[model samples]
Target: MRGLVWDGSELALVDDLLHRPPGPGEVVVEIATAGLCHSDLNPIDGKITQEVPVVLGHEAVGRIVERGPGVRLPIGTRVVLSVFRPCGACEHCRAGRRTACRRTAEPAATPFSRDGLPVQQFVRTGAFAERTVVSQSQAIPIPEELPDAEAAMLGCATVTAFGAVEERARVRRGETVLVVGAGGIGLNVVLAARAAGAGRIIVCDRNPRKHDIAVACGATDFFVTPEASDVAKACLDTVPDGADAAFECVGRADLLNATIASLGWGGRAVIVGLPSADTELSLRIRSLFHDKALLGCRMGSVDPRTALPELARRALAGEFSLTPLVTRVAPPSEAGDLIADLRRGELERGFFDLRGV
Candidate 1:
């Protein structure tokens, strides 16, 4: 089998990779499409450290081609692979806090190898490869009618956005929302906020080119600002008192601080982006005194078993369209350049059509 392997130094296509057969309660999926996410760039740029010789990619849709003992999902079933696979018996999972499950922090099993050396899976679902093994619980079934590229995004970006707006921020109808960054996750935050019946949705990004799509995704206003410090002012210029909720999707300390500052009294600011391991925040302590909250969101605080299916249903019903969010689709061999394009803000969202691999 062939897979995109990050070997501690660079990402390369290794055609000689070996795919380990599924063990008990596991399944092997033939990846159809995989979304290129900003999170995938963290390991490559040293923002996040990971074990080398690992397959990278967490957002993907695929079909089950092989199943191990105890697997109940039928072969040929289409599924959206989830990033979190919480152990049901863990204390957090028992308390309905699956994202905080202790097992999620443990090292995931490596089901791929090169030259007999085990290759770890990034975020436990290495969907960048032609095929990858995942625990049965991590493979959430989606309707076959959903497009592969769109379904792939539901695994991460869409879910994360919905989780931030609906679960973390608890945005209410007719409330105002401010989103920083207009990239993949940021745009989805706009869409999710709109679906939640937000009255005025404002989006801020450095890229003026993203304005059209941001508006299409339900932003009532878009602001292009070169400085992160100007975000709060721009947002307040429109809302006066400030927005009801703010989401920072760019993962920069400055942007997060600006997002917090853009919230009104009793407003909530949700951190939807993943910052570097060394990133720190500088804040005015008094800014959060007015019943304001600074919240941290992990995987949109969602349970994929229910969330993915509901998101799929909404998409199929035309409540929101995912096709507009996808800006490019290419083969896996172009993954490197595409990732760089994403890093440079040259693309809104890109995908890898792994079916040809």
Candidate 2:
């Protein structure tokens, strides 16, 4: 199999990558499409550390090609692969907080190998390759009506956006919402907020080119700015009394602080971006005194098994459109360039078609 491998120093396309057969409770998915996310860039750029060499991609949609014992999902069923693989025995999982499953932090068994040596999967689903194996629970089935590229996004961006707005922030009808970073996740946040019946949806991004899509995604107002302070100022300028809920989709400490500062009394700020492991945040003690909350969201606090199907249903019902959020689709050979385009804020969302890889 061919895969884009990150060998600690750089990403390279390798043709000899191999994956082991699925173990009990797992399934092998022949990846159709994989969404390139900012999270995939973290380890490559040193924003976060991971054991490498590894295949880097998690947001994927594919069809079950093989199944290990105990897996009930039939072969050829289309599904969205998720990074969140919760061990049902854990305390958090037992309490229905599957997103906080402690075992998720433990090292996952490397399924892919290069030259007979172990290669890790980014999270548990390395969908950048032609095929990848994952726990049965990590594969969430979707309707046939959902296109492969769009369904792939439900694995991460869309699920996270819906979770942030409906679960974490509990956004009420007619509330004012502010979102930072108009990339894949940010635009989805606009969609989620709009679906939550928000009165004002304000979005800020460094690229002016994203303004049109941001508005099309349901942003009532859009601001083109790069600085965190400037983004906050722009958000406040649009909603004078401060936003009722704020979501920072760009994982930067300064931006999170600005998000916190741009909230009204009793407002909630949800952190959706993944920051560097060593990054530290500075906060104004007084800013959080007005019942303001700074909430951390892990994978949008979503349980993929349940959340994905509902999102697919909503997509089928014309509740939200995923096509507009996608900026471009290319083959696995263009992974590096697409990632660079993403880092430069040049794409809203990019997908890798892995059908024949």
- Evaluated with lDDT, which candidate comes out highest? 1
Off by more than 4 A, model 1 = none
Q: State model 1's lDDT.
A: 0.91
Clashes of each: 0, 0
| TM-score of model number 1 | 0.98
lDDT (C-alpha, whole model) for all candidates:
0.91, 0.90
Per-prediction TM-score? 0.98, 0.97
Kindly list the per-residue Cα lDDT of model 1 for residues 26-89, writing each as its tens digit.
Answer: 9999999999998888788888878887899999999999999999999999999997878878
Error of 1 at 90 (Å): 2.7
